[model samples]
Target: MGKIPTTIPRRQLGRRLRDMRQEAGISIQDAARLIERGAGTLQRLEKGEANRIRMLDIQALCQIYDRMDELPGLLELAKVAASKDGEQGLWWNEYSDAIRDDFELYVRLEASASKLTVYQSEIIPGLVQTADYARTLGARYFSDTSSREIEQVVTVRLNRQRIITRRRNPVEVDLLLDENALRRVVGGPKVMAAALRRLADLPANVTIRVLPFSAGFPLGVACGPFVVLDFDRATGEPPTVYVEGYRGNLYYDRAEAVAQYRDTFRTLQAVASSPADSKQMLRRLAREYER
Candidate 1:
């Protein structure tokens, strides 16, 4: 078995470390000083970009944060992050070169999520996209790259859909697509028609609805694309909201922030067409595309 990416464990450890430091009201400089390390190093550790993590440093930080109760688990996570071997056979590793550094973390989180709630204003979400549709967007996004690289990117995306497509305990999906997504002629009308038909045929675990133009912005403001990832309690990871941007992505995990996004989703859901209606609408638009 090949070595798996330890990024997820590293990120989880980093989040816990940052949370503990904040909870204890310890400044990064102060904590770093006590740990006898540079502030930059501590920051990298908290960001999960640290290539090497020392058990002693983790213990000292735990002691300073008065979070000894969490020490054992933190140490275990640190060990895993620092180790060369991890779980085997994750497909993403095969296409690591195609994935952007910032987006890699989100992929890990998405794979681990028990449920996903998504909102897209202009384009179909990647998880639900057809191969040709994904390839079209991939080519545009990676215009400078070789065709092979673009294909790898598309493969990585299609692989991600497996989380929802797998037969055993597939992740539940609640996708809210703005009406504009349907009208957009991505990869031409033929591609759009095929994509919509696939969406209309999705399984029971996937609930897709369209927020029609008639709804006219239920929140009275345009909301960009975002995804909320809910994890199983056993993972000890908090629910996270991912906001993707042209330059960089943002993640919010604070309880209040997560709650606000949830409220926004519920509001949109109330106004969006019902799943049955949305399916009918999808088929209707698909037929139009066929014409």
Candidate 2:
């Protein structure tokens, strides 16, 4: 076991290994015995809960599963996962002390995603939040932390916005914001106004639509906030649904769960205002807030 945090590449590697093992019709216990390791250790590796992954172990498992052809890619994934320097290169890692492990995982996933479909019911999504809006939320959420620490959290959040603003192949973003998020004033009227204007003025890569109250429960129920992250197929990671909750967050990578969220998003999209109309509404709200 190693001390390094479980990373996205590590998790993907584990998932592929697990699938290969299952496809080969080998039980965990038998596979562990053949690899000269404990079943619990093999389980941890398959679950991506292992602190450190060994190349030798990966090779042994690949051999046992008769997946030699995949060894090269899996090995590469392992290299990336185990590389401390590579992990350090990520900008968010510098602020690890300011964020929770679950949040760190979310950030890593969000960074790698090629496309993002976000449905926010209350406050604005962090990726589009203005500095003041984010600072206000950070201050209350991190009430116990010092002002400097709160600032660090806010900085990390603003940095995340770069994924959509970056020059090279910026991530495609589709944001479905509930109208309440627009009407709800955060950080005072002026700050809220600025946040609305920012959303209305986002780059072409971002498509924002508002789900008005008149839509009347498009999904037939009150759905909370969730994000669907789709990665490049070359990464071998499945689409994921991130459900953020008060107590703990959940990540769903199973095909069925991801499909359900996607369908839900499409349904909401059908009822929501078009991107052009949404921007117009945002501008109108900003004017109201300015008054």
Please give, for residues 1-291, the per-residue lDDT of candidate 1 as tens digits. 123357667878998899899999999999999999999999989977786899999999989998899989989999988976663677787888989988988997888888999999999999999999999999998999999999998999899899898988789999999999999899999999999999999999999999999999789889999999998786667899999999999989889999999999999999999999999999999999999
Error of 1 at 50 (Å): 3.4
Residues 1-291, candidate 2, lDDT per residue (tens digit)?
112233667787888889999999999999999999999998878766576889999998989898899999999988877778656567776888988876777887888888999999998999999999999999999999999999998999999898899888899999999999998888899999999999999999999999999999987899999999998886667899999999998888889999999999999999999999999999999999999
The most accurate candidate by TM-score is 1
**What is residue 48's positional error in candidate 1, in angstroms?**
3.8
Clashes of each: 0, 1
Give per-model TM-scores. 0.91, 0.86
TM-score of 2: 0.86
- Range of the 10 consecutive residues with the lowest summed lDDT in candidate 1: 1-10
Model 2: lDDT to the true structure: 0.88
How much lDDT does each candidate structure score?
0.90, 0.88
Model 1: lDDT of residue 196: 98
